[model samples]
Target chain A: MTKSKLSQQLAVDNLKIGSHVYSSRLIVGTGKYPSEDIASKAINSSGAELVTLAIKRFSQQDAISNILEVIGEKKLLPNTAGTLNAKEALRSAQLSRELFKTNLIKLEIITSSENLDPNMPETIKAAEMMVKDNFEVYVYCDRDLNNCLKLEDLGCVAIMPLGSSIGSGRGFDDLDDLILLRNKIEQILIVDAGIGVPSEAARVMELGYDAVLVNSAIAYANEPILMASAFKNGVKSGRKTFLAGRMSRSKSSIASSPTQFLK
Target chain B: MSRIKIQLNGTVEQIESANLEIILNTFAPKDRPFAVEINGEIVPSAKFSDYSIQENDKIEIISAVGGG
Candidate 1:
């Protein structure tokens, strides 16, 4: 009989944002699924405690089942995905709070339609208003360190930097800045968007990111449920590796075998 | 029955009554969770029954959809 050292070494680690605590560091989005059944199954397999949903117009004559019915008891983090400016984002946030009855919001104010880049000024404006309105805002910004620092100063509960352009799946576009940003920011940092595989999730976690929000990689996969499970394991492994404290990188390779062995 | 015209979700619609709750119930199930706004102000669910809908009011009924 053997005991796993990794399990023994790690304590109970939970991701906390504002007053809410989540057990899973992987946050899943409920978008671009083939069906609600598949989305539900995939989300279940991922073991995500927090899920992101976007608020949109409710059609009058639509007979389709509501997405909320499948979400059940999982905590909802509503995002203002389509808003272009501060006013629209604020209204969307208010409506989301009223509908979901939660103050947790993912503030996204996209500036360009072609690239879908976030409007930094508009996002900051919306974030400040949301915070003043007593909402726990989680901002989605670019990798620019100065903008991220400004966002943190505005009282957001979490800062989500795009892994690449949204849904581009190019992995991390700027790894160096990501590492530096990790050292600077003290709030909960979750790398959101543009992550295509489990290994990338692992890589982000290995860099000591608190969490990762993935949607397209899992939702659009050939087998979403299986992919979801893979990401869950990836996140866990990365977190454990981070906790273990990785060996320092050396310019020259040191031989593993002892040089003076059996002399 | 007299009808009043108001904008519902960006479209002009004629309704039989001016009650907010009745209009909401007619379009959506009571069990479904959603939020209603009239001319840019959010109306709480509890107030739906007590609130009155005005003519030409731009009403937007919103709910959660899949997103990341």
Candidate 2:
């Protein structure tokens, strides 16, 4: 009935990344699912338009489940996971482009196995190479402002600043830095990693991130299907609330009821 | 069989025919999507049939694995 409600209902702006635009802002991962059936149902429920995959080696005799069949129309984001250097990451990117038939790459060269944080220097070099090679790089770098700016300058389509380390489920607590980065950079801003719950995903989206990439939170859940649905709602709610425009916070508490009445 | 040895995904194997296609057919289904590298060089799918594998070559076949 109100203008606010009307806008909330119509908060369906298409998310643009590079030359491509998508309707769903929640991007899910195709990893860690206990089974293909669960993976299929979870992603189907999540309302995700894209999913990330790690390119790995499987002997032809090994019968690993085909991820493409489960994703079903969702765009695939093949990442350079498990690679520790720019050279290896480059090769993985090339292979991913060939296999996924998409230019999009989540360029990640982790510094270590303990925490899958992007090694800044390696990531930057790989991003530069990938961009030059005509691949749309969605870089997974730290939330450092200058670093993000450099990545944008390198012609990456999107910059993913971690909420925390990958798969840690640490969530984005001190999101002020990310907010600052988002304000300064003109490129697509997506929160990737360290998100452990639906509320965390919603919070990041509410903070004005273009999208969020989620995996462990859902895939490792006791009930992945239910968690996936929760994430769908979370992203929707957060996007809606963001578009509706949240009321400015006050330094002091503002009473909704009559404080003078003392009831 | 006049076999030569090549390393496939970290395992050494003996093969009579030293071709990428033959090795690939032994491990992967033709219908699936995958990429191949011989001694760290990407061998385009178009050239799989012609690319010859040599003794002690490191062959890597990377396919789609789920991840975020």
TM-score of each: 0.94, 0.92
- Residue-wise lDDT of candidate 1 within A129-161, one digit each (tens)? 999999999999998999999899999999999
Interface root-mean-square deviation (Å) of every model = 1.2, 1.3
Place model 2 in a CAPRI quality band.
medium
lDDT of each: 0.88, 0.87
Candidate 2 residues lying further than 4 Å off, grouped into runs, are A1-12, A252-263
DockQ of each: 0.83, 0.74
lDDT of 1 at A236: 92
The TM-score of candidate 2 is 0.92
Among all candidates shown, the one with the greatest lDDT: 1
Cα-based lDDT at residue A150, candidate 1: 89
Candidate 1 chain A — worst ten consecutive residues by lDDT sum?
A: A1-10
